[model samples]
Structure formats: structure tokens, C-alpha cells
Target: MNRRSLIKAAGKAGAGALAVTALGGAMARAASTEPRAASAKPRIHVGSDPGIGRWSHAKSTSHEAGWTDQFQGMCTDGTYWYAVSNEGDNQRLHKLTLDFSSTVASLSAPRGSDHIGAPTFDPQRRQIYVPIEGPEPELIWKVSTGLSTVGIVPLAGRTPGSPAPQRWKCPWIALNPSDGLVYSSVFGDPERNDLDKYVDRVWAYDRDTGLLKKEIRLPSKVYAVQGGTFGNGGRNLYLASDYEEAGNERKHVYAYDFSAARDGSAVRSWGKVAIPDADDEVECVVFAHLTWRNARDTHITVGILDDGVFSGSTDNVYFRHLAVPSPGLI
Candidate 1:
């Protein structure tokens, strides 16, 4: 199966059953199987302002699939969103550079079609870490400028009934410059059990030990998980989906405020970032978003995901400017 099929399968499956508890696909099962330990702490606030305000999708003369969390990708400057797509017919990381308008650029991954599911940039090293799914031989490729292959790591096995590597693939990646650690989310196969859920957990990989240091579970499993810095040398990880929480029918952004989760640690439900209302419904949908930052601060450009005059699904990539409060506004 391909990425599109994986998403469609998720919608037809436990998606309905999750309406009661508000979780879907592999993530829902992971949440129920491993309940969160009580967070004695108060609800932490990760940002002074949090909301996507009025961003309509922007049609890039060059790219499509704007501002979506569906891919294992991150925004570069908080000014533009980019992704590595191995989706059917589409291959390569879709790059958009947004200024007054958006322009698309293509950077082919070192490997073939094994869809690029996760990507995080190490600005210091000028390197990009991307996870692969469904390639002839499964592996994750570390590509740098000139798209050099700096390192190659074999990923864990896929889940059974996992929808053929596309419908329900696992995404694992986390890099915080300040923490000096990488966190990866891993899952079991999708076909082995009748139950739809999977074992989803985050692990800290120490560069030296080569052994995962800490294993921490989340309040729930998040299919489109991405982590980055929020300006203060603190790590801000956000998970999104129109349907990704248990006991809550509404879509939500699970913000893990790990300003303090260094030294092999974990953070919890710090806050929620709301998904903007789409005129149409989206499913099993994995999307890549663009980013821009004045400096250390990072946020998506407005309307990069909104459908426009483009019509039909073609509207997936477009951006319209909206009034959003920022620290500058504060």
C-alpha cells in the first residue's frame, strides 16, 4: 500500500470507534494500552501566543501540500515549510521559500521511493535526518547539502496489518540542540493483533552509548510528531491530526513543553494548538508545513494549508495573510 491508502484505511477502521474516546488509527491504540502517568504538575503554557489565526493555503508557483503536519518534516526558518515526499508520483522533498510570495524548490533524497516520513534539520551540521518507508530495502537516510549521505541507520520492523507500510507507518524523530539529545518515537507492527492500537513510545538515543537511554510514553500516540526549538533554547514538540486524541472528538495540537525535559526526560500536555477549520474534511492525511522565524522563534506562515481558487484537493497548498498575535504584538 501507499501513503494515501494508509490514510484511507485509518479513516475506515477504528476512526469511528475512537469518536467515543477521541483517538484514531495506531495512535489511539497506543494511548489506551499505555495510559499516561498522572501529571502532578499544572497545565504548562509553552507559548505566549498559540493559534494559526487566519492562514489560508498559499499556492506556490512551485510546491503543493503546504503547512501540513502529516509529513516527518519541519519548517526551516519559520518562514517556509518543506517536506520529503515519496508519495505516489511525487518524489523528493517539496521545498517552498516564502517571502512576499512562495517559490518551490526540489531536493531529491539520496534513496529511492521509500517515502520520506520524518525529517528534522540540524542547522549546526547543516544536515537533515529523514526516515524511509516501503523502499526495496527499508532504512533511514541522513542527507546533507549536495544531498550527501552522511549516515544510514536501519529502522525497526514495521507493524503487522500496518497497511502495507504506507497506510500506517511509524514515524520516530526528535532533535533538540540545547538538550544535545535525539528522541525517536517507535511502534510495533500493525498486522499481528486484532486490536488496532500499537506500542508508541519516545526513546532518547545517546550518541555514544548507541543504546536508547530513556523510554517515555505520551498522553497518547501521535502519528505526525515533530519536535524543534521555541527560541529560548527550550524544545517545543507539537503533534497534530484532525483526529488524534482519546475521548475527544475534536482535533487538537498536543504541545509537549520540554523546556525542562533534558537529561533523558519527558514532558506532557503543556498546551493545545487548534487546527484551522477546512471547508472540506481531510483524513489519514499526512501534510508538510512551511516555516519562518525572525530568529530563534519558529511558526508557520499563514494560510499555507488553506484551499484556494486552485479547486478540489489541488487547494492543499496556498497561503493568505491573517492577523496573528506574536511576541512582537505582545
Candidate 2:
């Protein structure tokens, strides 16, 4: 639990900048310790992430196409930036502008549950909440990402259709930009092995009163979810790592205080936060959604997208910048 900076990449980060590299003291406390440590812990030399205080970016140089891969579920409309590409069979859904270009609406998923996890954007209810993952009865669409704005209306009572068999897993998207309230977590299928299936759901809705308002029921099964702002003023909800094996799982990150939920389905926790995989700690590990950049109200950035595949990692997907060694707190 001792970390100020931690991001790593063994080698080959797609070959395009963001090479991040740094490790301070005791090798940044033994690269974040955890290799089942029977002993020996100091080597330090994590990866990327260096400037958010102490860990900005190592030598990686921020390239690897600036970290872009099938990466699904991500939102930002401050001026541009939106994702839902996990690319896997070519699944698409796009919007970008922070210089990434390519806009005019992407959306390309007609089957396979269309994946695309927790993505939000409401700017006064202009609407743009994508929650696709079909296989069962789990489906959320809500469109008009932009172009609609009257007395204030958009996305009402599921009708975009397409529902049946979606066992939503790894889904994450939390937004409370004042009263947007869209926290979600109903996850399962960490990477995929299917252990009979056991995942407790977590939810909260009210983009404008589709009204479902938090309904958490957990014993486990929750890989990622983030939302926090104003420090202690009015928001903070994060929970990741719910345990799973083989198929990959285990990272652990928790923090709740959504006003202590008075009915949105009880959620009150002011502790437990983990994501330090010093070593051997890589099994469907989760931490790729914590973006609240610049200086908007405060600081809250936590994103980890290392598509560098691993096992030898070198298919490409690195460059979220580099050098992120530390107490393993991804």
C-alpha cells in the first residue's frame, strides 16, 4: 500500500514512444512487491505513468499509437474523445477529437452482444450512454451522443431494442457530474473460462430518471468501476478486482461514498484499494478506466491500457506513456 507511482512494461511496447521508465528508492520498493515474495523484492523498473504527481511516463515516449487498441468503453466530451472498440471481431463504435480525429459517429455492432461497455456522455442530457452486451437480458443503448437538445430530453425507456442472453461482464462506467448518476458494475467473465458463473451486480441509474438508482448485491465479482471528484465534497465510487482464476482475475480496488446511498442500494465504504501486482500478479488484472484529467475541479486519473499482450508482450498496444514501477497500485 505504499505507492506514489507504478506503471511497468517488461519490454517491446509497440515501438512508438511512451517508453516510460523510473524506479526510486529500494527500486521503487521492489517494483511493488508481490511475486509471492518468500523473500527478495527490490528491482524496481515498472513502466509508463510518471506525471500525475510522481510517475508520469518513463522512456516509452508515449507512442504505441498513443495507446489505442480494441479498447472498449471510454467517454469524454469536454471537447472530444470517446471509445468502444475492443476491436475483437472488428466491433466498432467511435468518436475522437483530442487530435485523434475520426468522428461522425462510428457504431458498428449488429450481433455478438455488440460488446461496448459502460460509456457515458450527457452534457445537459444531450445523451450518449452506450451499454451493450447481449447474450441474455442485459442491454443498454441510449443514443443521440450529440444533436438533441430541447427543453432537455433524450434516451427514454429502452426501445433501441436488442435484448436476450447478455451476461454483462467487465462493464464499467460511472458519471455523477453533478446529477448524472450512472454508476455501473454488473460484471462477470473476467477474461473468460466461465467458472459456472458467479458475479454479484452493482448499478445506479438516473441519466434523467430512467431511474434505477444503485442496486448493489455483492459477495464478489466486480472488476472495474470508477468515479470521484471534489475530494470529499460529492462523489467517489471505485471498486475493482472481484476474484477469478485461470480465466484471469484479482486486482482489488474499492472506495465508495456516493452520498452513502440512502436508497440507491446501500454502498458505504471508505477503504480497501489495491492494484499492486509487483510480480506474477497478472491475471485478468483490471484497471483501465479512471480518466478525469487536466484541472477540472481537481485531479483523478487512473487508466491502464497495456495491450502489450504479455507472456512475452509484443503484439503492440503499449504507449500510454511508459515507466510505471512502484508498489504495484495499478
Candidate 3:
């Protein structure tokens, strides 16, 4: 089926529900074992925190003109922005203007991988770290700013004592400049009763070698994390969750203190901002300093893929530029 018909069919079934259905099988098999009770309750609460400041929407731009496949993750290098789209045999990585007004260039997904997830940019190495989901033993591809594949890091079979041999499914990745490590985790379902069992910790990899460095356990689990990036000058890690509970009209972007996690201290959410879109699927989040035309400022941008399947609209994608009092200026 073509894009339009596929979207129409998906719409009738419900876009969010369709995504869960399409991705659910892999997630279930990826779980090492059945959910069991935790030894102790997490220190942090499951819901939003009041201390976190709210992000106000500043502006948005559509990608309808230069439409790719379903938008996945996005990041920036203080100047241009980079994004990825996954369409199973036709995935792509896109370079865009700071405002996301137009696509500057595009590259086909590296050979051997079809589904590309959230991506992070490394300024020192000048490469974009992209998460690849399928064809088993998920991998992370390092592509240069010029859009050429530089290196490939296989994630599976690296961690010791991991129950399953092929469980690493990279849905998103983020780079921490301070420690020079890239972070990623297996996707989880927020609505599942045993959500904590699946997404209890995040794996950090050596930035250059892609070797398994360490696993940082969270004080609380954040389910269905579609995207992640380091914000506040690499002091905090921000995550975006796409799963919206039944009858709930909002999803959330969560924040965690990176320094505290490194110190092995009790880390809780600094705050969360609710994205009020019920129809569109939230894909990824990135913090960057952007300057376009006469406007110059910083933003905590979230990528919202138009689920024409749910919204009954054309295939489109856009980024919502959100503002906070202080964004740590990238």
C-alpha cells in the first residue's frame, strides 16, 4: 500500500494504538523474563514534579514539503539540526535548518539497517550517533556531518550476564559532553503493569569506541522513552515519553540531573513538561541554541509526527520549539 492508504488504514485502527501494535512484539520478546516484584519501591514519584519549570511554545515549522518517512529522533550541533525517519526499507537521515524550515541535505540509512531511531551529535568527533532498531543485534551508526557513515557499533553481546543474547533495541540515544559517553535504553510501555521491570536503567557507551561503559540505574523508571538528549550544559538528561494512557490527553518530557546519577546519589525528576497533543505521536526531544533570520535564542524542541493515521490529515511532521526561563544556552 502507498503512504496515503497505509495512513488511512492506520487512522481507522488509531495511530497510537497502531504504533504500539507494530512495535509491541519486539518489546515483549526483548524482555528477558516475566515481570516480578521489585525488591523495593523507587525513591521518586511516577507523576510530574512541581519544582520543574514549564516550557512555553515559541514557534513551529512543517516538513510536509520535503516529507520523509515517519519522523523518529532529532539533535543539533549548535548550528544545523539533524533528524531521522524510519520506514523499514526506506529510512533516511535528514539535515535541516535551525528553524526546521527546509531540508538542507539527506542520506540513506547505512546498509544492513532499516529502522533508525533517535540520534545525537558529537561536536568533537563531528559525527551524528544514530540508533538502528532492526535486523537483530541493534546497532549505533556514526555518520559524519557531511552525511557519510564513519563507524558502526553493535550493542548486543557486549553487556555481561544479559539474560537474552539479542535484547538491545536502540530506540533513542543521547550524548553527554561532560563524560563523553552516549546513552541509550530498551523501549518500554508506560501503561504496562510491569513497566519498571523493562526500563529500570540506561546503558552508557564509550563515545568513540562504542564499548559498553556502564549502566546507570534510575531512582524511578520512565516508560516508553522515545527520545533523549543532554540539556543544561550537559548537566541534566531530558527524556521524551510517547505512550499516552487511555483517556489521557497529554504525554511528557522528563528531566534528570546527570551529575547526581554519576555520583551514585538518589536522582529524581527535576521536572516535566506536558505536551498536550492527543492525536500526533511524540517522537523525540533536543535542547539547542538556534538562530534563524533575525531571531536568536535557545529551545527545548520536541518532534511531533503528525499521525495522519489518527488525525485524518496528510503525511506531515513538525518540531515545536519550547522555551524555558533558562535553557543553559546549549
Candidate 4:
């Protein structure tokens, strides 16, 4: 059976029931098979400013069909939003309306590439930068707005004089319009001993040639980074983490200042924004200029994969729109 059929069958087989619990001020949903410990709490590292401010729960939309299940990451072209999903051998990219009210188009993963992660849009090229993992070496694929593959940038072996082939499991990527560079981070726990020493650093690549430009060392160890986007005229990078443990809630979006690192100064104090849903896995975050009620406004959009409702008939993907004082233009 296909992935969607399998999800539906599993849902019918009682995988949809979720146990809800209140932990502190947030809520947690425990699956029927695996229960969470009552003592579990999210790990919070809120900077003094916490720049994003309180995210107002705006609106959420769920996709139940075959092509759009298990959303991994998302980006916007100012007018429309593009999302990527991976299901076993089936990986697809979907185009949706700005509000995510409906799907406009869907395309399968490019040949020879399997798992697709978060994607970013390039306004100059009018293309989407998709992070594809597997098929030996990972790649950053440049795709057209119509969902067609236009170019490919091999991520491995880009680091000069590397002792071995660098296998960067790029789960998320973002575009810096000001400098015309694409940024990506290694997936999973960067602090883990088994991971490469450089995994903790964010890699920036030239947009046109795809050559390794430079690596930015993070001020702190960020674990399980799933998605990231640029804001404040590409001066600040916002990253989302999906690290969750029995006693630690690592589902947070962090912001780092790029300008602070340029002058050999301390990378400035970081900012943090917590994802309210304790049960859902945080996916991707993007900044978009959206039109609501014929009014244009900028918003910080976050994608959450609601595992808590996987077994139920409800939609599993939640597109959360957050209101920030000034999201800054890209």
C-alpha cells in the first residue's frame, strides 16, 4: 500500500487515539503505545529579549491526502507557499495558497533523490532551494515555481581539505537575499560525539556556483535543528529545533545575528521563541509577506506536524501564523 493508505489503515487500527496531559502551562499529547512521564518539561533557553514575542495561535490547516502527508518543511514566494513532505520512498513538494487554505499543485521528488527536507525560495531566481537527503550524497536542488528541477548542487565534498567525505544531512536550508547565499545546518544533535566536529557549524554556500563560502559557528549547541529562515534583512537567522525528551522540551525557534559575527565580535545575544504545542513535532519556519483581507503584512510562519492527531481523522499538519512587532523584509 502507498504511504497515505498505510497512514489511513494505521489510523483505523487505533493509532489515532492520543492522551492529553497538562504540563505546566502547555499541553502534551501522549500516544497510546508510548506514554510520556509526568515529570517531563521542555528545555527553555530564552534570551533576555526573546525577540519573536508571544505567538498568537492564528489558523491551522491539515492535509489528509496522499501527496501532502508528513510535512517536513516550508517556504514562501511572497504570493504562494511551498511545502515538502517525505513518506518512505514517496517524497513530494506541494504548492499552496498563501493562507494554506488549499493545494495548488504537487510534484514528486526528483529522480535519484529520496528524502526531501525543508525548502527556501529565491526571489531573484524565482526558484525553490530544496534539501534532499540520500541517494549517496545529499544535494540542494533548485526547483522552479511550477515544481520542476532546474539545477542541483552537490553538498558533499564541498569542504576543502576535508579528511573524509562530509556527509551533511541537511534537513533545513534558508536563503539570504542580501548576500545571495544559501545557508544550511547539519541535522540531529550536533553536540553528539558520533557526529562530525563541524556539524555544529552552519554552512553558507554561494548561490550561483554552489561553492562553500564560509561556516558560521553557533554561539551555543543547538540540537535537532529541523528548519531555518532569514529575517531582518538577512542579518538574523531563525532556526527551529525538534528535540524532545522525557524531561526536556527543546521545541523552540532561535534567532542569531549574522552581523555580530562579521567583525570578530561575540555573536550577540540570541533570541528564542517556544512552540506552544508540546505534543507536536516542530517542522519548518519561514518569513512571508502575506495579504489578508486585501491588506499586506509580514508574518513569521511556522509548520508543526501534529503527531498527537495522527491516529484521528483530523488534519496532522498545522501552519501557524505568528505576529511579530517587525519581522523585517527579506
Evaluate residue 292 in candidate 1 and report its C-alpha lDDT on the 0 to 100 scale. 23
TM-score each candidate.
0.56, 0.25, 0.74, 0.73
Give the root-mean-square deviation of each candidate in angstroms: 12.2, 20.1, 12.2, 11.5
Give the local distance difference test score of model 1: 0.37
Quality of model 4 by C-alpha lDDT: 0.57
The residue-by-residue lDDT of candidate 1 on 123-163, one tens digit each, is 55655555554433334456654445677654432332222
Ranked candidates (TM-score, high to low): 3, 4, 1, 2
Ranking by lDDT: 3, 4, 1, 2
Roughly what TM-score does model 1 have, to 2 decimal places?
A: 0.56
Better of 2 and 3 by TM-score: 3
lDDT per residue for candidate 3 within 1-330, as digits (tens), equals 222233234321101101100000110000121212223222332232323355666555556644335767676664456777665466788887644557888888877664577788776687888877555556778888888888887764354433222254566777776677787776665433442224667777765555677667776766666778775435567777776644555677777766656523455667677765524777777665333332323256677776454443445776665656543322
- Which is better, 3 or 4, measured by lDDT? 3
Q: Against the correct fold, how does model 2 do in TM-score?
A: 0.25
What lDDT does the true structure give each of the candidates? Answer: 0.37, 0.35, 0.58, 0.57
Native-to-model Cα distance after best TM-score fit, residue 237 in candidate 4, in Å: 0.1
lDDT of 2 by residue, 252-308 (tens): 444455544544355445444333331211112112222222211111223344444
Residue 153 CA error for candidate 2 (Å)? 19
Clashes of each: 42, 53, 1, 5
